[model samples]
Target chain A: MKGTFRASMAWLHTGLGLVTGWVLFAIALSGSLSVFREGISVWMRPELPTVPVQTVDATAHAVAWLTDHAAKSSAWYLAVPNHRAPYVFGTWERPDGSYIQKALNPLTGSPDGIRDTLGGEFFYRFHFELQLPYPYGRLIAAIAALALVVGLISGLIIHRRIFADFFTFRPNKGQRSWLDAHNLLGVLAFPFHLMISFTGAVTLVTMLLPWGPQAVYKQDVMAGYTDLDPALESRAASGKPGHLTAITPLLQNAEERFRGAGISQVYIYNPSDAASLVTVIAGNNGTVSTLSHSLTFDGTTGRLIREHVETRPAVRTYTFLYGLHIARFTPDVTRWLYFISGLMLTAVIGSGMRLWTVKRLRLPHHLGHVLTDRLNVGVLGGTSLAFASYFLANRLLPPMSPHRAGHEVQCVFIVWGLALVFALIRPARRAWPEMLAACALACFAIAAVSSPWTNPVTQSTALVSLLFSGAFGYAAFRALNGKAKQT
Target chain B: MESAGTLRRPLATAGKSLSLKRWDLACRILAALPGGYALAAFSGICLAVWLPGLRVERAMTGMLTGLLIWPVAFMASFAVPDGRKMLGGTVIALLALMGLAALRGWRP
Candidate 1:
């Protein structure tokens, strides 16, 4: 019975892991890249000048602009710029559901017209959304995450001696070497892998299982959310228009209230109306939880209206898990740790997929075996190549072209689609190295075009690109030399 | 050891028969998809109704725990070995949780 149980788990791990391996690889790799989304975004748009310091009252400037330009808006949001970000982002909702957003210069308060590219948002969204339509994309990502959790648990159960092979690595043994590397990466990052998947599922729980709130709140999710996180609220715009007060005072008041906590965002509800409200959300830089302490004030008079700090045990647990998954509260050093750990998990997934093909390559002529091998290269190598092309497109595309951002995304898919076609036509052994070589070239192209020596943001982008290029270049060299097949 | 090997050998041999393989695949799918999902949902509702906390908090806790429950249920779908046992165990656990949930909600 014990043998049978372990066998069943082993089968479950292999079967389900193979079925969803490609999507999991893509998700992990993209998520790893999105750790530096801000830096990547800054690199993509070089026209924006570097923000000197955090001296400007961006909240006041953004509010002043909205008072002049978007006075009729029912709701206004101001995203204060940090060290990495150069511009204050503003968004206002019309009477209808549509929203208008702009990037404003933190110093001058004028709109920054760098480019229309989606920038890093494309990779961030693709990490969880996969660019699919609406709820389906998110639902698929959640399901994939759930499958990963199942696979990991089953794997732990099957591998009886967890530490027996901890220090084992045998090169030139082909499938054995791949298996050893897979196990090594998996065991090394097991805790992170489990935590990431579990928290990822919990983060999407509201959407994945809407019934939980529906049954408890009698289908009134808004009421439930008010208790869960009450920082956000909307008020109708009064038809009677009025002048606004200076927002610097409100921001200063919020900082005082939170004991000098940095203000991350400012909100104006029904701005320029008699019944308007101003809300300032506390930053989570030093905090362990993702939920920001919020203070709402009367927009007209600048008097404190309401304050919410989530202290409930259940909500705190949720926020902690959310913070761990997103790592928004981590400092720069810890954030890089998270990024490297995320990349390690990506390597684990990729190596496991490779092991699948290497094991089946025993029967070389089998179509299923060939298909898996080609797919290993096509999906893994193709995605890496596509991401590099995305950066390349950002550099090459004309800045003023309409739908410039859309074309950048299209470039990613076009390159990826071509690689997939090439994978199908070429031998698996040949396809792997070829795609990897292309990935290496694209990485170099992005690094060269960005000219990373100028600014800190560009420097970070160049460093990451060069690192990937070196890794891919070495891997391509090994694959070309026929040494990639050894265990 | 011989008996255990014998028990496993027949399952491997059964795969050679397409019809048996198809039936086994169907059973596995049934146990994994609907069976596991129902168990998670019922257990969640049971905890949500009976657990000590505010209504939303209890629901959130129950739902998060329920998400964890799904992987166990999924693994059990295969761990049970026998297709009949897998389906039967899943239905029983799901129905039991549902009954507990109903009784908890009956106070109205």
Candidate 2:
């Protein structure tokens, strides 16, 4: 009975992992890159000056720019300059229901000379959205995350010698080697895998399992959200034009109220109306919880209207789990650890998928095995190549090109689709080494094109790309050597 | 004649058992996925309506609890080999939870 139970779990783990592994791999790899989302954004836009600017000064500059250019806009959202992202990022809603995003110069507050691109936001959004239309991508990602949680737990139950096999690796043994690598990666980062996958699902729980909230709130879903993350009540525009009060004093007031917590974001609603409101949100640099501590003031009079802070245990727990998954409050070392762990998780999924095909490849070759093998190479190797192409596109695309950001994202999918086609046409033995070599070349090209000496962010990004190039290059060499031996 | 009849009877039984096993496997898979998810959702609704807390807090706790319950429910669906018993038990629990939620004024 015990033996049968373990075998059943093994079956469950294999089937679940194989079915959901591709989407999980893509999500995990993008998520790993998104660890340095701001840094990548800064690196992609080399035109932006990286001079450190004070938050207050940056806020003032952003508000001044918005007041001049977007006075007729209904609302303006601004993110003050920080160490990681050294520019004032602003988005305003136009009366036509469209939105414009621009990075403002911290010093001059001008939206001049900055290239248009999603920057790091592409990876961050792709991590959850998979580039699919609204709600669908999020739904798919949430379900995949839950499937990962189930896979990890079942895997833990099936592996009998988990500790004994921790140090095991047998190279050049085909299926054995793949299994060993999968187990090693899975075991070494087991806790991180569990935490990340579980928390990832939790982050989207309200979406995936909305029945509870829906039942309670009936039709007022927005009320449920307002309760979970309390925000200041929005006021209607009076339609009469009023003088907008200065933002510096309002920021100072919020800072004092926060007791030294930095203000990260500010939102001005109805900036040109008599009933305007300015809300200041405290940064998460000091806390692991992503819950915002905000103060709203009258935009015209600059009088404090309300302060929103959450002390509820359930909400705090939810925010903490969400915060942990996003890693927004992580310091430098912790952030690196998150990145490395994310990569390890990706490797686990990649290797496990490879193991599935490896175990069956020795049997009579079937179409199922053939398709899985090709897709393993296509997705595992192709995604890395696609990500590199995204970076390459950032540099190669003309800065003034229309829809430049959209084109950069298009390069990623186009290259990825081409890689998949290439994988399908080529033999598995040859495809593995070739795709890996291409990925290595792309990484090397990214490193070569990027100027490493400009700033720490660029320097580190270049170094990381070079390191990835070396790693992929070595894997390609091993794969080629194995192919030669087989022949 | 008797020997031929015995041989044919065993072959027929073997074929029937094979089909039975396939049906059982399909039922279990269905139970694990959809049935387990339903159980989790019903449990969440129960908690949301019954838990003594603020509306938001109860709702959030309910959602988190449901997420935590899903994997366990998935495993439980497979732990028992008898597919009919496993699925039927899940359905019964879901119904009970739904009843409890309804009693607490949960509309959906």
* Interface DockQ of each model: 0.30, 0.25
Q: The CA-based lDDT of model 1 is what?
A: 0.77
- lDDT per residue (tens digit) for residues A46-131 in model 2: 98876768888888988888888889998999988778888888889987988887788888787778888888989999999999
In candidate 2, chain A reaches a TM of 0.97
- Stretches of model 1 off by over 4 angstroms after superposition: A93-102, A483-487, B1-25, B106-108
For candidate 1, the chain B TM-score comes to 0.73
Q: What is the C-alpha lDDT profile of model 2 across B10-101, one tens digit per residue?
A: 11110011223776777787788898788879888898889897998888888999998888888776667687788778788888998898
Fnat for the candidates in order:
0.42, 0.52
TM-score per candidate, in order?
A: 0.91, 0.94
Per-candidate iRMS values, in order, are: 5.6, 9.5
- Write the residue-wise lDDT of candidate 1 on A1-487 in tens digits: 8867777777778888889889999999898888787677778777776757352376577677777777888888877877766677677887677876566766667564667666676788899899898899898888889998988887777655567547656666676667667777778778988999888887787777665565667757678877776766556666777667777877887887767557777878887788888888877767767655888888788877778887877778888888788876778897798899889989988987898777767754688878878878889999999988999999899987877878999999999999888988888788877889999999988789978478777777788889999999988888888645452
Give the number of the best model, judged by DockQ. 1
